[model samples]
Target chain A: MSHVTDEVKGYIGVETDVGRCWDVVERGAVRRFAQAIMDLDPAFMSEEYAAQTPYGKPVAPPLFPLMQNRLPYDGTDVISERADDPDYDGTGGAGPSSNLPPLPLGNLALLNGGSEVELFRYLHHGEGLSFRHRYADIYERETSKGLMVFVITETDYLDDDGGLVARVKRTTIRR
Target chain B: MRDNDAARADAPADPRHFEDVSLGERLGDLQKGPFTTPHLMRWSAAIENWHKIHYDRDFTQQHDKLPDLLVNGSLKQNFLLQIVKDWATPHGWPWKVSFQFRAMDVVGSTLFVWGAVKRKIPLRDFGLVELELGIRNQEDRQSTPGKATVALPYREGGPVPYPFVPPSADELAAGEARAEGA
Candidate 1:
């Protein structure tokens, strides 16, 4: 018997803006990210060093663009909003941050299941990237924790020239 | 993965050759953290997700059933990429990677990201190196388990193709057939 409803299954091909960052890959931003991750690879950080590499200029770490998203609000709005529910996860609590469609399964806990990624090229400084997302599938299974839903989404990060940057298949587990 | 610190220090300064790699060869360990609140905070700020599960111990423990502030999966993936990317750079391309978030690593623990060459296949232009990799906490508990395929240049070549294109469908089918035959 299926625990997932027909309506939920209908989302199999639904689209979401999981993220879309078209801004130029900034060097400062790349440095901050690499520093935070503690990856001091010159390919990602130093333009002088990267200039000597095959890429000719500093490139964002392969996965750096995935984290580069701009929220639609200013900082004050968020601070004021977070003043109440001290328990708030800083997720703005206003919406599912990824722009994922509201799940019919209310209040269900969402967990990161895993991901499959294909990288075609390095995203470099001065390059702009765009994202396209779709609900690839939704299914349910009986786990030791009881019934859980697995939602898979496919996102493509494309360069301005329509070149492939990275293609990701992300899975979210709902319990 | 083999951790030959002596061998790593003696690694060639030039691009690596696919012919040099062997199955079961261990990659240099890429370590990150003893991550603290500031580390988590920086990552959250960079990614723009203030999910308190990573910073708020009270909410994470009381509201959610977690022991402490959790390291962000987003952060983990980036570290995974860095491990493969730095290892592949100057020669190889970290072409395709897949990893699962099997377990959670709470903040305040160092992570040893390790990789080992699992297999290699000869291709028309270059060779494909498959690797098994993961993140291990201070206690040696694995968290993110992954597999990656890297394309390496032949020693005679100048460099792997820039903006490396994905193999076409025909190429993939042929590769599959070859694998089955082998």
Candidate 2:
């Protein structure tokens, strides 16, 4: 593995739009998501049960926005492009969640380290939601395997009124 | 908490009264999976990604040197959220939740997402409760461990403000002052 250089460290504080997509939180999507997580919260599915709650409407699961932002079609998709290369080791690819710049590391295995998230509100049915994403930071640490790099990206999900829904800081690891 | 038992057992929560909560109250365990290849693929499909490592055993083993088709970290996070989300339910708002995968959870492993009340801070209008949470595999090895904070309205204080609002710095200081005084 190459040393984590100054060029790589420069990516810190670098930000990208990662685009804004508008969506109406639908009941069907919420149902599927709740099922996928095995969380059968009525507030996410049963209209009669949800209307009795403070929200007065069915809402998406807490992390639903992560699913809403699908694979972006930038004409040359990093994930798809890398898939065509037979040598790809099934790592170091980006998904809809972050816009962190690709690191200088070549052909290293990657893992979704984990995340820290803050939720101020839920995305409810029929409400318009927008997501703002940016690469918050990048850093490296020495490991027994060698040197490893960690990428931190922050995303803010907002309602149409621009009120905050959730703020997420995701960590991706490369070794 | 096995995956099948917990899913079959969980019922809807009633609005929890702030007065009823106490330190060390167990937010009942949540179990998920015997997660198989199909379960992993469904999650990948749910998120609309076709990451070959999740589905292609040849690619994962021959190229990546992994033990098996790895369970999605994203999926594990969802299970972690499920525990607190349902625990808070109609009464309390799951204000903030976070966790990390301390070890890899491979395919065919069942996960038990568990949490317990850590601390409770009484606010003027509501109560903020903190808890330590984690997911453990069938073998009782813990993988993801983290903590969360939730806002629960007082039984008499009315529903948590619709579109929840986080305590500001000044409010937090005042709450701390109140907490110390109590």
CA lDDT of each prediction against the hidden true structure: 0.76, 0.76
Model 1's TM-score against the true structure: 0.88
Residue A18's lDDT within candidate 1 is 33
Candidate 2 docks at the CAPRI level of medium
Model 1: per-residue Cα lDDT at residue B14:
76
> Would candidate 1 be rated incorrect, acceptable, medium or high by CAPRI criteria?
medium
Candidate 1, residue A98: the lDDT equals: 59
| Tens-digit per-residue lDDT, B10-114, candidate 1 | 222577788888879988787788889999999887766777788988878887778899998888887777778767875678889888988889989888898
> How does each model score on TM-score?
0.88, 0.90
Instruction: Point out where model 2 deviates above 4 Å.
Output: A1-3, A22-24, A72-83, A89-94, A98-100, B1-12, B180-182
lDDT of 1 at B76: 89
Candidate 1 segments exceeding 4 Å error: A1-3, A16-22, A73-88, A92-97, B1-12, B173-182
